[model samples]
Target: MISDGVSVEALTQWQEATVGSLLSQALNRWPDRAAIRWPTPTGLKTLTWKQVWDSAASGAAQLRADDPTPIAIFAPNSEGWYLSLWAVALSGRPLVPINPALTEREVRAILMDSGASIVLAARDYRGRNLLEAVARLNIVDIQHLWDVDDWISATQSATGAIGAVAPQSTFVIQYTSGTTGTPKGVMLAHRACVNAASTLIATLEPGDDETCCSPSALHHVGALIAHALALARIGATYVMMNEFSAQGFVEAAASSRATILAGVPTMYSRVLDDPSFADVKLPDVRVLMLGGASIPVTLVSRLESHFGARVAVMYGQSEAPVITATRLDDPAWMKAHTVGRALPHREIQILGVATRSPADVGQIGEICVRTPVRMVGYLNLPDATSKAIDDEGWLHTGDLGALDVEGRLYFHGRLREMIVRGGENIYAREVEEVIESHPRVAEVAVVGLPDSDWGEIVAAAVVPRTGATVSADELSAWVERHLARYKRPTSWRFVDELPMTASGKPKKFAIVEWFGAIDGN
Candidate 1:
């Protein structure tokens, strides 16, 4: 029946079902409600639930006769993105959403690896033209290349049998954010999507008319599954932003009177840094759901003080959406320190070095989770799937963390991201937290560089605050005072900006590459 905090009405309203069925229910319940709203060239465009459904149905009818090979969607956040997603699911085929920021080479790799037979993409976004991007791809598996406009066209008269997708069938193959290495396609079932959305909606309990402003990309978990689908579950209005800017987000929320706002820590930092943010007043704002990367405590404090909105820090990987989130009613300390206890009917465990046994309370270990919402596995990689999800069905997350006596999870850095300096383990997040605390440092990333003597040396890449400057030596001294001598950065580089994945996580590999290039190594 879901968690105690969730009302009985919500529990019954949210059952495990195919995403196609859920969309149908939403259309029947809120036919005339404003379902999707985004800015266009001439002006803003708003689509009702019925319009969205009818458009998707037309696309589904056309695709129902084709083979179920996964379709690759390469476009920015737009109404066309959602329409293609819903249409593919209704046709009983998996849809793979690719980040528009990926290089042509990277996109080619994913296309070849997934063996996608169909591609739906926009002509252009910002300056990057998708038509040119597709021309650069050397792969031959793609049987059809439908423009985003034509794929979601409401005027198409194609009519055919729309197959019913089983709840256990895969709906989307969401690729992992390639911060450390090449991205892998994660297979997510329809039931998993439904359960994850319901769990999040039930936990937040947003009103039926709750208006949500989402600045994150539609391809990512935060926007696609958690924010968009969750809002639709409650028949809420969704205010979509194609591209995120501090000024745009502030104005959109203020204009729409959005009650909920969601984004990554970097996005929120940009908002706070923007001078125009001071002029915007969002009295209807109730909560700011922060996810993607480790959040700074200072950011949370500033949001609460300035906006008078509760900040909920959410933690999850692409494999398992919404594993843990600090509830809005939780105390300030809990919200700041830990990603709250497991959601309803979900189990989380911390395994020690042994990897088989649970760690003692307050002991740091690898975080493993078992939930119905867990992904099926990585696409076309059975060995990788076996390694990720064990025989016992527990998804072994590479993240290291500790669980308190009360079952709250305290996240460390990724197990692979640990910088081993002369046999001593230094978590990147631990050192990053120290450097980011500096007044002049707006953002920082800590990584390990290969060294002949130390085996691996710690390095830091710093992004200065706008109109602020600090020398590398100054930052070194700041860290030296706060952290141990070994934990301090042995090398530092100041950059205008850090390379980031679409989800806003710093690409540490890219930072290391840039540092190496600068050093002429």
Candidate 2:
């Protein structure tokens, strides 16, 4: 296995550290440095490493004095939101971070399923009042509820109660949307968080003065681990946004002099499409880490050209956080084509779909990983957990990919997302990448529609650029030139925009339903 700039000894040393301990170390090292920075409607705000640690200690002490049930935080990205997560971990309780964009029913399901007894949320955001929604649920498990303002204001002296937390204990239960349209709670241990943060800090080599600007929500794994925990581990600065806007991110990066920017592909797309994108200049930014979704080959080139920064594409899921990440010093071709090799202490193997055996080099198969940075299991779902994690402890990711001889992973598409047309297997991402290469295509999603003749035919739904008109025939002709005839999209639907999930992934099920309704199938 490749070392990837980190060593096994270093990973082992961090194996027994809890999230609370990690933050404490950072606070001790840089008590006066700014730990968190964000722009509010009132003005810009800042928090020192000592302030965050003390707030977390106070919150932890308060929760321990109360019922101490699983704590649920429903709020946007803010300094308070970030501290609450650390507070729960330090209190020896599992934290459940619900997406603020979830519907009332969805929020209720998570609170009830996770048995969360304490809730901390914003009074209202984006026209949704979480307090109102919680009042309607009437969940008995929730014994205490406080708004963000009240929670932050009630900070008391640090009681040093965080020392009670164990290293291997459960830290958070992150609920992610499943294929069946229900959210499954993935339990992550403190060691898992430590492992993930260690890998990210070692591979990325975050400098002491480096400031990172993150646009992802506090609930996302990328934000919780890569942006928050990793930043604390290295004593770097964090600049977060309450709401994501292309222009807002650009302005924040420029003003904060951010050296690193982390985001999903959709966020980058919006930034590139902004009207004032050409005028923005952020000279301090040296790295742009894009993940949590597909990164188009063309977008990588455009990002580097515009920002004068090296782009590093990372690949991982909620189950295993940041298993692989490309380096900043890697070649441009490697950064654009592959997601890089496995982390120093992690093991990745591509297993064949039908045979259930390891695939040879350059062969596409299901991407499986064995790593310390993994979820404990799905909460209260034994069968589902068993099916996802095998007997030997390998987490079988549903995504399909292949490994090069040098251990670099080349992602194909989701195993369920592959289309079988006339007994020929066709990957949707291969088609999507080709379609996204077209200059007029702003965004595209490829799905399989029910077809009696071919069993399932390749279909694509595309959103053209603003003020651009694109026909189905022209896109079909373009696809035929890059891919095989069978792999080309049999049907194309042009729309104003593509539906996305709360975590910024293309909603394939919604796209399929739309196609069925239009075709009368």
Candidate 3:
């Protein structure tokens, strides 16, 4: 059984470790164990621990020979992407991952911001020629850009020794989703990533033979720390998906006999919506992990019943990889409602917005976290870093939540997203939960629209289930039965789908624009 208390010994051992050291340890302990499984059009490709180490060493040598500065990877999830990540990690240079879904302009902005001269990119992903597109940008800062396949081939044939790196050195410059504003480069040190992955490994206690099916993008922290690094620490196998499709995920899970499945709420909903999901039997799956967004209670219950697996919920951000997670044995309500208590070696506090002091139990306030897993700072933005992490070492998360007497956290909503209708505050999450509970609703995103009379009014963008229809009057009456009049949505838009980020969170800014376009305001 997992203990709630922190493990001092584990922290002491991992506090000064680098990703290279972790790779070495895995190589020594589990030389013959399967480290990765990549499904291709031809067949399944499996790599042993020793093979992964050799490939990483070769790639690292090539990187050290070509450039000494931080490198960037622009590709979808694939064997080439994994090899590139290991190459950068072993080379003692930071890696900047750019989402494949981003536009050329967005990609150029990140490259310029990160100053990554060497970029290993895919030749083509989905339908776009990523290499040609990046070449078209012709950013002068980008000195060397190699197609991912060519780079892998060149690196695999080369050989060199791994460089020595400090534990506190930055390993990755992860960019935020930029849903609220321009994306910031979050500097994550080797120690922080190692410690965070170790903490989660201890909590999950995955077996050596376990296989995890992950469909989340490798660029996001959820896939990097939680699934990839965590699985590598234990020498387990992880199945990679280049793109997420309900049919693809179900097929992969069945073929791999996966023990753990990880994804965001939207991915889970899609899998359940797939017709083949009802016919498949995944008896080997033991845990279904959810992260990246708020999970609806109904979704949790449905996942548990469908997969016959325990649902484990986690909450985190790019600034802090993972703050809290629910255990496998947690009660159903606790798993569905709360984000669980703070993880080991982490402290969570609800700070009063006005005074910036600790709020009383069950009182809503801005969520603050003090943990070793936090990012060093925003790259090249000292003022922004200071504003995010205070002098007291507390990282003000800007998310509003409350803690119960037992220390379990209940997330309310984003502090900035709160709606103040004539001085009364309304949390978007509260209203969303009610609408999602309705039988006809598939998903909903609530926002605060500008109103001249009430200052700001509640607005909702709802996606109804396929072939199911419900009018505004029906939803208004449904919400009225559960929420106060002030909290109910005054404006509604029945969209086929909500705009979403790559990591699966709804894009609130885009929804607000939709409403604005309709109102001509």
Candidate 4:
């Protein structure tokens, strides 16, 4: 076990020290400093540390007045949802954040499974009225928390339940996509939350003036909890966009004067593709953190040109809080490719025959990690939870990689056959699902093949759905705009039928061999 030498996590009373408490301390220390900001069609709104705390306290008080633990929140990225996240933790209540992009049916499943009592959703999102969907959740109180008027009224009511909550208390219930079956909710305990935040803050060394804007899904650990709270803990500024829009992101970075920005590869791809990038002067952006999918080498140069070569290509996952991150201080070449070094408090041991250990120099194997920030367990999935976190407490990351003699980490390949096209993860089954949704699509399988430009491009093979005439171009354009662009298949192939076993799963590798490529175009 590595000693952190007295920091955020690993301290005894951590569970009681809620993310709310961390915000409160920031508020007291820098009462006037801007804690969070977002640009609206009308204007930009900034929240001070104190203001964020009080709003959270108001939310905690309101939710605690009714339920003692685990309040629910469902909304696109917004200040209201962020406040409620803090409020729930402060009142010693766990927060359950559901995916806003999920269809109503999908949304309902998570709410019911997590047992979230109070649900806070937006009344309006991009002019789409989703309150009806929130209403259907049948949660205890389907309050529109983003109602600026309602939130302001609630915060000013002197209803904040002022108290200290332990860090070990349940803070949030994060649900993993149940592709194999039903999605399981992961209850992140307070100690784990503090440990995750402290691990990142101490290693990343977020400065007091540092500002971070992330396009990751808010319900995921990267945004709602890990990156968001970690920013507050370090007294840095936080910024959110209602949704990830390429043009909107460029504007937000400049509008908020954010110094630090983290986003998946797809988010940056559009920015790079735009001819206007040369004109969109995001001058204040000092550090750029890249993750989710493989970072494009082209992007490294573009980012260097844009941000003065201060880029960090990081590798992370929801299961393990940020495991590796590079810095602006590292060699520019290393910053462009390597996933940097293992986090300060983490231990890495490559598992397999050729992997003699880090001292072996050129070794390749799965990346197993032991850290203070890992989650307690996945909700209602004991067998899976046990498999994920071994008895030794080392997290067996599915990614394959190697450590050089210089102690830098280099990503090799994946143990699991998951597709990452433009930073949006396209689970084979998930894409194979949508392709089969077409009326003409009879059978289909999806895979991530190599691409020189966008890293891995999404490709698909389909067997027309029984005499239905669905042309490749039409299907490509159809699926393109339907799903998130990153998940959309760039290429497609129509076949007589798909190859499957007696149990029925696309022999993805074999399909790749037969079809040559999965192309929709």
| Top TM-score prediction, candidate number | 3
Clashing pairs in 3: none
Task: Give the poorly placed runs of model 4, Cα more than 4 Å off.
Answer: 1-16, 126-128, 137-152, 158-160, 177-182, 202-205, 353-361, 418-521
226: Cα error in model 1, Å: 1.2
lDDT (10s digit) by residue, model 2, range 365-440: 9999997789899999999999999999999988899999999998887898988989998988889989988888
Full-model lDDT for every candidate: 0.82, 0.83, 0.84, 0.66
Arranged by lDDT, best first: 3, 2, 1, 4
For each candidate in turn, the TM-score is 0.95, 0.95, 0.96, 0.74
Better of 3 and 4 by TM-score: 3
Tens-digit lDDT string for candidate 3 (1-521): 21223343453344678877767877887788778887788767888889888888888888888666779889888888887787788889999999988999999889988999898888888888888889999888788889876776776678667779889999999999865567899999998998888777666656547789988999887789887787777667889888888888888888888999989888888778767577676999998989888877688888888888888888888999889888888877888788887888789999987788999999989999998889999999999999999999999887889999999999877788888899998888889999999988888999999888999999999998767898899999999999989999989999888888777888888888889999998
Q: Write the per-residue lDDT of candidate 4 for residues 1-521, one digit (tens) a residue.
A: 12113343343223435676677778777788888888888867899888887777676666666656455666677777777677767778777877666678887777667666666676776665566676765665343334522553565675644666776666778775432234567777776776567656555544447778766666776666546777776677888777777778888888788888877655675576566675775778877777655444456666777666377666666566667877657866676557888765677777763343332555666778887666667776789888878888888876666688766877653555567666655555445545655555545667677787877877787765333578878887777756877888777777775553211234556666665633342
Judged by whole-model lDDT over C-alpha atoms, candidate 4 comes out at 0.66
- Looking at candidate 1, what is the lDDT of residue 330? 81
Range of the 10 consecutive residues with the lowest summed lDDT in candidate 4: 1-10
lDDT of 4 at 359: 29
